[model samples]
Target: MAARRHTTTRRPVLAAAAAFLLPPNPVAAAERLAFDDLYSGWSVMGASFSPRLLALVGQEAALRGYMAPPLKAEADFFVLAREPMALCPFCSSDADWPVDIVVVYLRRQAQPTDPGTRIEVVGRVETGSWTDPDSGFVSQIRLRDARFRPL
Candidate 1:
């Protein structure tokens, strides 16, 4: 009688190593932040940014939310909402966005992100009252220099 020994090759391990060397998707780097943590206070006048949001200024923050209708379909900025927005921005001039909204300023004019879509936004958390020169929309909490993609 004879006994046989089997050996495994290193090719599979090498292939796995190569796959790991590939660059990671940019969207994967966006950190998730909840709406509850976006602000500490809510009011008609203005809302205060939470401590977590304040600390993220000038840093990339990822917010998972729905897209509120833009003031204009072709506007540069759009509001990220916690829920599907029922109000139309164009229909009502007095209609205000939520206090926790993260104003998204896209890098370029692109198709609006899906209103029903859950998206992650990566941008600098800008806190202050700033008026949009193009749309004249006022916002206390903004996510400037931002980019977004559907989740």
Candidate 2:
């Protein structure tokens, strides 16, 4: 009897399965930003965004920080701060936001987490002064269409 010959054909099947299971590549990776890099100069009058920050406007970016309290229980927007804020500036007048704070406008409404929890936010960087029509909250810089994940 001739020795049995077996040819395995599983390699291609395995490769195809891997390709299907893998996560799709993002259109573009977000540029990581540090709070210290948000500004070139800061004063009582106002702050000037760093050249790097300015150049990144309209581009996808990521910032790691604490998420300040939201205006409502379920909201689409929140504030990202280097530290936990004493007050939710967007919802209060007694406390003011830090110059380097970045407003985060999420793509969908979400239940906010504790103020102390650190988070990483991803979105398109938007510069210049603007006020939210609904809340009348003024912001110098913001992350539009943003989303966040706990750190």
**Best by TM-score, which number?**
2
Clashing pairs in 1: none
lDDT (Cα, tens digit) per residue for candidate 1, span 37-139: 7778878885777777788887777777888878797856898889988766587555565556667897677788768888777777788889889888777
Off by over 4 Å in 1: 1-24, 42-46, 88-94
- What is candidate 2's TM-score against the reference? 0.75
Q: Which candidate tops lDDT?
A: 2
Query: Which ten contiguous residues of candidate 1 have the minimum total lDDT?
Result: 1-10
Which digits, one per residue and each the tens of the lDDT, describe model 2 over residues 27-125?
Answer: 125666789879989788867889889989999887889987786577788878899877644676644567677899998888897899988788899
- TM-score, one value per model: 0.72, 0.75
Residue 145 in model 2: lDDT: 88
